[model samples]
Target chain A: MYSYSEFDEAFVRERVSQFRAQVERRIDGSLTEDEFKPLRLMNGLYLQLHAYMLRVAIPYGTLAPHQMRQLAMIAERWDKGYGHFTTRQNIQFNWPKLKDVPDILDALADVEMHAIQTSGNTIRNVTADHFAGAAADEIADPRPVAELLRQWSTDHPEFQFLPRKFKIAITGSPNDRAVTKAHDIGLRMVRNEAGEEGFEVIVGGGLGRTPMIGKVIREFLPREDLLPYVEAIVSVWNLLGRRDNKFKARIKITVHEHGIEEIRRLVEDRFTEIRPGFSGVDQEVLAGLEAAFARPSLPERSLGGFESAYTNDPVFRAWSDTNVAEHAVPGYGIVTISLKAHGKTPGDASADQMRLMADLAEELGHSEIRISHEQNVILPHVHKSDLPRVHAALKEAGLGTANVGLASDIIACPGMDYCALATARSIPIAQEIAERVDELKIEHEVGHLKIKISGCINACGHHHVGHIGILGLDRAGVENYQITLGGDGTESASIGERAGPGFSADQIVPAIERLILAYLDLRESDSETFIQSYRRLGPAPFKAALYPETAEKERADAA
Target chain B: MSRKFTPKVVTGNALIEGDAVWLTEDDRWTREMSEAELIEDEAHAQMRLLFGQSQPSVVVGVYLADAKAGLNGPEPTHFREDFRTRGPSNYPHGKQATA
Candidate 1:
């Protein structure tokens, strides 16, 4: 993790003081609500349905344990004793008082984190693969590149007020855990034909009312040219993007309206013009950023305790099987502590749990904690010798739901329950599904599933990419859930197809239950996942499972 | 003839605390939806909403929400408003947390 330089610290402190004065001006009645709205949003404060929500940026999903502890402190002091980790790799404090926001900003500055660029039509947090540095398949850590992008994009004057919000995700590995395909700009580190590492630049991918898989603007951009090339893409979109309609303002729509080839041509033209402005200073910054990320390496360690725990303890073995991912280091493993405990709110970590994780990260892990886009916390570089201890601590803290990629590990956005834009509640629906899945004890058996729920069509929960996507809507004043099938968010990203008529709030859980059970029966073997089964046989079987009543009516009609 | 207007109440989130609040007939912002002034006429609802919006320092994002005459005062018709009456269903932290 990169510690903030004196300059960086000064910049953040200045921003905080400016926001504090702005907040004071608003409270003192000098600034109108309309005037204060943008200022507050610029500081990542939003008046949500039930309360004021403060979104704090977690750059590249990486957190030093001390930073994590500071976050815990903020949650305990000013928030509702908990923080919700969003799908965008940010933490939102839901119950922040307006008067306390400036204090919160000041506190965040203390830890070199800020809420800047979290909202407004600006470049938001730059997220990366949670397992970036530790993943066995990664060629290099993507955080340095992500950090460089973060620095370049933060408060950049020319691009601050673009047509709409922009997001960028980067990953080091070919297997895209960063959901690169679903971002406005996705950068995947790849090796060129010459065996030199470069980036496969993807642009215009987003999910909302309109879901798009980002187009490959640059198939293989040289490592040194990343900053300039990315700048060109955003610059092209800033000028050409539609400002008329909010829905059509995203770069994804721009790409859709203007062909990718034409867009690429414009980007190349812009790259030529602006490439000189960089003057290789970005390279110097990137080199310094890379060195800052050179944390103590995960040296090989004895795995005897780990092996014995795996063999002897069924509980530990189950958790290890579900939550652990292979690390690049010989004896280390990446542990994703599932926040999606069955029947509990997904992605929410209590202040105590956050503190515990911070302490555990310092003690057992390499003092590094990562917040995954899946809403789980990651100890990306934990030695196998420490896995049992880490798991034990997490288990004791009620953070030991061993369902990382399983059916019960669902991603649900804060629907009508908290969001003003939500048409219906999504949390209860997510809760019911997870509870049923756990009650059946077939989550592990049902195997590798991505169940995502969105409160609305905004798809903040990444519902468009789930194998079982549940979209909550309001119909005739009643809550309705529409299911989408066969959506994926990996290297092979595709928008999910809507299954059929929406189910009522009462019927949705049962509908999802039927769908999962059907997948279990339809699958060829345990190895076949829900997505694999769906792709192999198509939506017919899943639709039949989701709408058994309609399927029966159709059968009668055919008969 | 114009269609009869449904009952409505002026609502906004408290500026300082950000709690969901409804305007009472006595010109007070109350967190309790049951204490809200449910306007039967469309003109009264619009006026009440304007008044709510006027209190910029007291509230933010004022609007009229569909309401109905309840045993006490006003009851929300839409689920969104109903959710605001209570807090998020995921946890017991909102008004319903203790209720």
Candidate 2:
């Protein structure tokens, strides 16, 4: 994890003081609602359905044990005893009072965390692969680059007020765990023909009302030229991006209007103008960051406990099988703590739960806790021998869920339950789906499947990439759900195609049950996942499952 | 032909607490939806909305919500207003918790 420097510390403290003054002004009636709204939004405050939601940025999903403890403290003292971890790798406290926000920010700054630039038109939190440092297949940890971008874009003078909000995602590995293809600027670290490490720069990929796969502008960009080149891309988009219609203001629409080739040419031209100004200072900064992010040494440890526990304890074995991933080290494993326990709200952790996780991370997980975009917590480095103890602690807290990528481990936005912008209730739908899957006892048997739900068309839940995507909408005052099949978010990213007619809220869970049953019957083998089966058979059978009467009517007409 | 105006209530969130509040006939911002003055006429609803919006520092996002005359006083017609009257379905917090 990267610790804040003196400058960072002072800058954050200054922002808190400024916000404190602004809050006073608003309370005293000096600032109007319109005036305070943007100011509040810039500091990651938003008026939601029930209360104000404060989104605190967990920079690149990294947290120290003390920071985690402080977050728990804030939840206990200021919020509703719990906080929500979002798909953007940030934590949202849904019930902070306006009067307490400044104090909440002061508390956050005490732990070197702040909500600055988590919202508004400026660059949001720079996200990376949750398995960045620990994944066995990682070429290098993406944190250094992610942190560099964070430092550069925090309050970039030239790009503060862009045409619209911009998002950036980077990954060091070829596996693409960060969903790089769906970001405004996707940076994938790659080794060129000469074996020199560089990046494949992807531009204009986004998911919202309009979803588009990012196009590769530069197949290989030397690591040294990252700052100037990225500036050039954002600069060009800032100029060419639409401002009249907020709907068409993203870089994706800009890229759509002017073809990727033209955009690439413009970026190259802009790069020529701005390249000399960068002057290798970013590389020097990166070297310092790399030193700060150095992984702790893990000497060899015995796996006798791990082996015995796996063999003797069925519950431990089940959790290890589902929630654990291979770490870069030989005697270590990456543990994903599932926030989606059966029938509970996804991504919500109580203050006690947070404190327990903090202790667990410090004692057993190298004091490092990572929040993943999939709404789960990751202990990046845990010894295999300590697996049983970790599992025991998690189980005691009702946090030891054996589903990570299973069907029951769904990613859902706050939806109508908490979000003011949501069209329908996403949380209840997700809860019902998880309960149904649990009741059927088919999650482990069903194997790895992603079911992402979004309350609105904002795509905050990454519903477009779900293996079984459920988009909740308000069709003429009633809650309606539309299902999509075969969407993927990986090295091979593709948007999901919509199935036939939407289902009512009452009929949705059963409809999903029918789809899964049909998938089980249609799959060629157990090894074939849901996405594979859908691709092999196409949407015909799944459509039939979703709308049996329509499929029957069509069959009869064809016959 | 244009549809007739439905019964409505002036609603907003308290600026300090950020909880749901409804405008009453006596110019009070009450937390309970049942305490709100249900306006059947469009003109009266607009007047109530103006009254809600006037308290800029005390409230935020003042608007009219569809309602119906109930035995309690006023009932929310939309599920959203119903949610606001109580709280989120998942957690027993907000008005529901206290009530």
Candidate 3:
């Protein structure tokens, strides 16, 4: 994990002091709500449906045990004894008094953390692969680059107030766990023809009212030119991108309106103008950041004990099967702690649980923990020998869920329950659906299904990329949900198609059950997963299952 | 109607571990106070000053009220007594309590 340099520490401390004064001003009535809203948003504070929420950024999802413990302390002290981990790999305290937020930021700064850029139109936290440094197939670790970007983008004077919020994601490997292709700017490390590592830069991809898969503006950008090129792309967008309509303000909408070729031409022109300014200073800075991310040395050990433990313990075997993944190191494995326990609220961890995770991270695994964009925690460098003990500890702490990529692991936004913008309840609906799927005992058979729920068109839950997407809406003062099928979140990402009609909150669970059973019945064989069947057969069969009456009417017309 | 309001202590979720409270009488805080006293009527006045005016009235008690109802309705105050009475703060009251 990367430790904060003295400069970084001083910068955050200054920012905290600045915000404390701003809070005091707001309370004194010198700054009105209109004047105070933007300042609070810049610091990741929001007045939601019920209470104030303070979102703290876990930069690139990386955390030291002490940082994790600090988060637990915050929850215990200022919140409702728990924190909700968000899909963006950040944690949100759903309850905090306006007066105490400054104190919270101060406490976070003590641990070298802050909520800066976690919200607002500035470049939000730069996300990367959860298994970045540890993935066996990785060409290089992406976190060093992510950390470098974090340093450069933090309160960049020019880009602080973009037309809309910007997101950037990087991946070290081609497997694309970070969903790089679906971000404002996606950087994937790749090798050129000369066998030198560089980046394949993609721009304009995002999910919102308008969902777009990013277009590749540069096939391969040399590593040294990363910052200059990014500056060129953002500058081009800032000057030329539409500011007329809020809905059409994102770079994706600009790319859609002007066409990718034109956008590419503009970016190329901008890049040429700025390429001369690229100095060796960026390379030296990146080198320093890379040194900070030096991998932990593995102890000399054999995996014979791990093999025996897995064979003897069924629970450990199940966890190892689902949660453990191949590590870059021979004797180590990356362990994912699934927050989606069946029938419970997804992505919520009690203060006690957070403390327990911190202790376990220090004791059984490496002293580093990672939060995934999927809202799970990763003990990125656990030895194979420690798997059984870790699994036992996790089970006791209610964090040992054996569903990592499975169906019950749903990603939902803070819907009507918390978000004022939300039309219906997203979290409880996701909870109910997971509970139903568990009761049916068909999640294993369903196999790697992603069911995402968004409470509104804002699409914070990323419903557009789920195998089965549930969109909650308000209809005649009642909560209604719409279902979509065949959405994917991978190298081959696609927007899902909506099925027939929307169902009321009470009717949505059975509707989803019907859709799943229909897939089961129409599947070529049990070997085929829901996504495969949906893709191969298209929405016709799923639509038929959802609205048999419509299908019958169509058949009768054809007859 | 003019009614005398008693002094009480207001408590909320603590910063570190124990509890946070403010005393209504002195407009100061003492670490020592029972949870029961923290739920009294005058305790709420302190809560309003600390948390904000829009905080939900979870527990309320009064020495005087509408004579027809005999302490049934809430005690009269300078602010409106209607169910939909607005809070004093420019920002909505109780917005910070949820966080």
The best candidate in terms of lDDT: 2
lDDT per residue as tens, model 3, A1-559: 6778899899889888889998788766666666777998999988764457899999999999899999999998988788889888999988787779989999999998999999888899999999988899999999999998998899899899898889999999988888887899999999999999999999999887888888998999999989988888888888877777888889998888898899888888888998888678878989988888878887868788799989998878978988999998888999999999987677888889899889988997778799988888999999999888889888998889888888788998878766757777788788888889989988777767889999898988989888999999878657789998888877788888888689998888888888888988888988888899998998888888888789999999999
Predicted candidate 1 versus true structure: per-residue lDDT over A1-559, tens digit per residue: 7888898899899999999999888888899899999999999999999899999999999998888888889999998789999999999999999999999999899889999999999999999999988899998999999999988898899888999999999999988999999999999999988999999999999999999998998889999999889989988999998999888999999999899999999999999998888888889989998898875776777899999999999999999999999988788889999999999999999989999999998998878899999999999888998899998999999998899999988898988888888888888998999999999998988889999999999999899999889999889999999999999999988899999899998899898899988988999998988899999999998888877778899999999
CA deviation > 4 Å runs, candidate 2: none
Name the better of 2 and 3 by TM-score.
Answer: 2
Candidate 2, DockQ score (0 to 1): 0.82
Give each prediction's DockQ, rounded to 2 decimals: 0.85, 0.82, 0.04
Clashing pairs in 2: none
**Residue pairs with backbone overlap in model 3:** A51-B98, A94-B99, A95-B98, A95-B99, A96-B99, B54-B93
TM-score of chain A of each: 0.99, 0.99, 0.98
The lDDT for every candidate, in the order shown, is 0.91, 0.93, 0.79
Collision count for each candidate, in order: 0, 0, 6
Query: Candidate 3 regions off by >4 Å?
Result: A557-559, B1-99
Tens digits of per-residue lDDT, candidate 1, B21-98, equal 999999999989999898999888878888888889889999988899989889998878888898988888878875
Clashing pairs in 1: none
